[model samples]
Target: MAALADAEHRLGRGLPDDLRQLLLECDGIIGHTAVDTVWSVEQIVAQNLLFRTDSSFAQLYMSFDALLFFGDNGGGDQFAFVQTPQRPDIFVWEHETDSRRWVAGDLRDYLGRSLAEGGDAWYQ
Candidate 1:
């Protein structure tokens, strides 16, 4: 709980309830091919901060202000929760195309699919 509190403070926003509950159970989830399907609290804070503030990212991709990144695909793609409207749905941010698309209904559904028999790009 302390970690989550610190993360929320650093990000200046509350995390999704489902993600907070999951992190309380486990720091992170290692999914197919040993990927960090769900990132630890520290990583979540750091990554989101980077994506939101990095000047290089601003030039390279679309604004990340609406996305709270939580994990990666072991490649370049990343998974995140939409923050602008604050929804439970998970979306995949394709690094190459800079496209964001819906992948799961919630954290539980995301874990079920990402950890199942489908390598790192399970959502694709």
Candidate 2:
């Protein structure tokens, strides 16, 4: 929980409650084929900053003020929370297309769906 707060403080925004709880339960998820790993708190901050600074992700940079990257498929596609007022929707950023698509309404929904589908490949 402290880690999550620290991350939110660094990010200058509060993360969704469900996400914070999930992180507390497990720093990250592993042993899943569809998702290589869910990032740790530090990794979330670092990856977000990396993407924010990289010119290659200019499309994402131009559109979103902040993105909380949580997971990645081994292939480079990423899963993240998009900062939005309505709800912080989970989005899948396809590396090949350099495009992001809303995949779930919130963290809880995303988890339910991901588990129902057996893995993150359902998004791909």
Candidate 3:
């Protein structure tokens, strides 16, 4: 837990609200019984499980003001993005990483791309 928090602080990014809430529960900040889903991100990161999805195009949400997705970008190695969920659809470039396969898409790359000049589209 400390490792995860430190990594998040040093990198300055977080999982989607829903995922974070689940983590908080695991951290004893909330009741574990509150969780309804069977898959936990913690387990994924710990290599206890794999992504349970129907397709390779996985949908990931972040607490940060950016939209990120990681998977094969049509071909080659799995690609990563820090994209704007809005018109113009500005996106950030990033590389793939083991941690990103669960939490972030190479935080360094996404952090740079997600910090462009624009208000969050989520509120718009």
Give each model's clash number.
Answer: 0, 0, 1
Off by over 4 Å in 1: none
On residues 1-124, what C-alpha lDDT tens digit does candidate 1 reach at each position? 7989999999999999999999999999888788999999999999999998999999999999999999999898999999999999999999999999999999989989998885887788
Q: Model 2: clashing residue pairs?
A: none
lDDT for 50 (candidate 2)? 77
lDDT of 2 by residue, 3-122 (tens): 888998887777767778878898876636646456778888777777777776675435445467787766787888877553668988887776888888887777666666466576
- The predicted structure with the larger lDDT, 2 or 3, is 2
Worst 10 residues of 2 by lDDT: 59-68
Residue by residue across 1-124, what tens digits does model 3's lDDT show?
A: 6755753453345444433454556632211233211223343233211232323434442232343232222222222234333222223222242233322334343333323334222111
Which candidate wins on TM-score? 1
Q: Give the 10-residue window scoring lowest on summed lDDT in candidate 1.
A: 115-124
Q: How far is candidate 2 from the true structure (C-alpha RMSD, Å)?
A: 2.6
Of the candidates shown, which would achieve the greatest lDDT relative to the real structure? Answer: 1
lDDT (C-alpha) at residue 83 in model 2: 72
Candidate RMSDs in order: 0.7, 2.6, 13.9
Query: Which of the two, 1 or 2, has more TM-score?
Result: 1
